[model samples]
Structures are given as structure tokens and as C-alpha cells.
Target: MFARRALLGLAAALALSTAAPAQTQAQTQAQAQAPNPRVRIETAEGPIVLELYADKAPKTVANYLKYVDRGLFDGASFYRASKPPGYAPNDYGVIQGGLQNDPKKVLPPVAHEPTTQTGIKHVSGVISMGRHAPGTAQADWFIVIGDQDYLDADPKDPKKTPGFAAFGKVVEGMDVAQTILGKPVDPKAGTGAMKGEMLVKPVRIVRVRRVQ
Candidate 1:
């Protein structure tokens, strides 16, 4: 009788262990298949909707979600506007923003996700992260207002050359990013920035959160 009861308990436990993961997997699949999480970045000009591509770039998405979850991006401002050095300032338009208002929330760098691996193009209005001198990209990211082919990983030199990892595109807010790029700035002024401390206007990221 004891042996039979033990066997029955073991079988029940085993069945539960197996079923639990299956249920969890189904739940996860339901969430993953759900609509992509959307975030609206309210800027000085208008609001821009950014559809985060977590499925495509897991690391990048997870890193960005860390920022959002911590409320680090709220009330932050974009302070750097680099005109890509000599390209007529307007040609290579870019606006840098993220978790700058509060230095306390700047998280450490996560693993880098290269464009080649991500398969995401660096087209206009695509938002990406900027790494430190070497492999040290923190929470600092930028919005591309124009085609950024230079940002793509060099095919010939693959992993050697640093490539900007693109995690998401501005699905409904290209106009906002464009408005930011079009904002006038002193080309001769504001060279390389240690932080995003040179963005011309007070282009602020009002908030960064999942569209719940």
C-alpha cells in the first residue's frame, strides 16, 4: 500500500511539473504573439510612437525595457545634436536622447547587438543606441532622421567595426524625429559630448513606458 501511494504521488508531481511549463509556454506565446509594445515619446514639437522590436532584438529590447521599467527615461531630455561633422549639418541629421535628466538611472552597458545579427535596417526615423569609445554603450540612444548607412556594420570588416544596434523603428513618429532634426543648431558650436549635453532645443523625452 505504501509503495503504491508513493508511486501515485510521484506520478502526480511529475505530471504537474510537465504541465506547468506547458501552460507557461502557452501563456508566453500568447503574450509574444500579441501586438508589439508601443511607446510614445512626447517631444517639444509633437509625440512620436516607437514600436519596440523585442522579438527581433531580444538583448536590445530587454536593455531598453530595463530603462522604461525603472522610469529612468521620464522627463529626460535630448541634449546632443551632431550634424555628422562636415555633411552640411542638415544632411546627416541626428538627435540624441535618453535617461540623461537623472544620472542616477544610467544603467551599465549590456551586451551589444549588431545590425548584421539583428537584420534591422538603419533607415530614416530608426532609433538606435550609441556606444562609448569602445564596447561601452549605456542607456544613451539616438534617433536617425535620415538614412544612416555609415551606422551599418561594414560587411567586409564584420564584428571588428562597431555597429549601432537598432532595436526599434519610429513607426508613427517619423515627423517628430524629423522635426527634431530640422531644429536649427549652431554647426560650429557643440562638439563631441561626454553626455547628451549639447542638443540645441529642450527636446525632452517626456516619458518612456509601455503602452498599456
Candidate 2:
């Protein structure tokens, strides 16, 4: 009976030792998978808070944060607001902002991170980079006003049509984003692809800063 009791006690001790490691591992994993950093974009219209997905798009997030850290967006403005044409819903489009390829503010283009690779999408309130071609995105970015699956990378033909990189989303003040999207546009302010998309009165970005 003494030997049997000793064996039972040893087994219990071993079980606890094993369970403790498992619990610790789970806690470590949870910490590693925690949500990415967040920032506050204070615009003339209002403030928009964004949560950047660093795990999903590390390079893209890093590039964006670089500009944020340097105050590149301090005096930037939302120069364009594209809405759907007649017969289509007006609520579906994007509001673009950032350095706008200004020679002084533009940084070197970052590598493209397609949604296919990052697992992010250009859904409503999601923020994405604006580029003339793949891998040409620098400081310009846009905020989707509605579901925009077409902006997501095409899984079948990623080489030909690598869609825009989506790294973040508006966690608060999406209403401010929508309000900016509803602002008036100049009929003949832009040319070519941006012919009718240019905002008549651009919304100023007062400042951008990291937030807890």
C-alpha cells in the first residue's frame, strides 16, 4: 500500500509539471498573437483611429509607421474622393490622402504586399496603399468607404494584377472617413485617371501620432 501511494503521488506530480508547461506555452502564444499597434490621424474634419496589422503586413505597417513617426502627414491633405457614377450607389468609393507624391515628402517605394500574401482585404473602413503600379507605392494611401473586394489581390492571377496592400483599418471615427468621402469634388481639377476625383476643398491632416 505504501509503494502504491508513492507511485500515485509521483504520477500526480508529473501530470502537474506537464500541464504547467502547456499553460505557459499557451500564454506565450497569446501574447505573440496580440493585436498590432494603433494610431490616431487627426484631420481637419475629425479624428480617425486606425489599428495596423503588423503581423499580417509587417513591411507595409513599418513603412506607414515610418512616415507617422517623422510627421510626414502633419500638413498633408485628402486630395481625392472617388464615388460611384450615376446608376450606382454613391456610398462605395475611396478617400485618398498622404504625401501625394510630393517631391519633398515622398519616400522610396516599398515592396508590394498583396492581400493574397498578407491575408488582409480592402473592406469598408480598411486602409490601403495607393500605387500607379505594383511596388510603386510610397506615401500615398486610401481609405475604402465600402466593401471593395475588387481591390484585393487576385489569387489566380497575382502576377498580372497584384492588388493594393491593405495594412490597417479605421477602428474609430469611420464616420469621419465617410464624411470626408462625401466632400465635394472638382469637375475639372484633375486629368487622366483622376479627372473627376479631385477634392475641391481638400481635408487637411492636422497630425498623426501613435496611440496606446
lDDT of 1 by residue, 117-168 (tens): 8887788878888886545677888888778788887778866776788888
TM-scores, one per candidate:
0.78, 0.83
Cα lDDT, all candidates: 0.76, 0.92
Model 1: lowest-lDDT 10 consecutive positions: 188-197
What's the distance in Å from true for residue 10, model 1? 12
lDDT of 2: 0.92
- What lDDT would candidate 1 get against the real structure? 0.76
- Which residue pairs come into collision in candidate 1? 79-199, 80-199
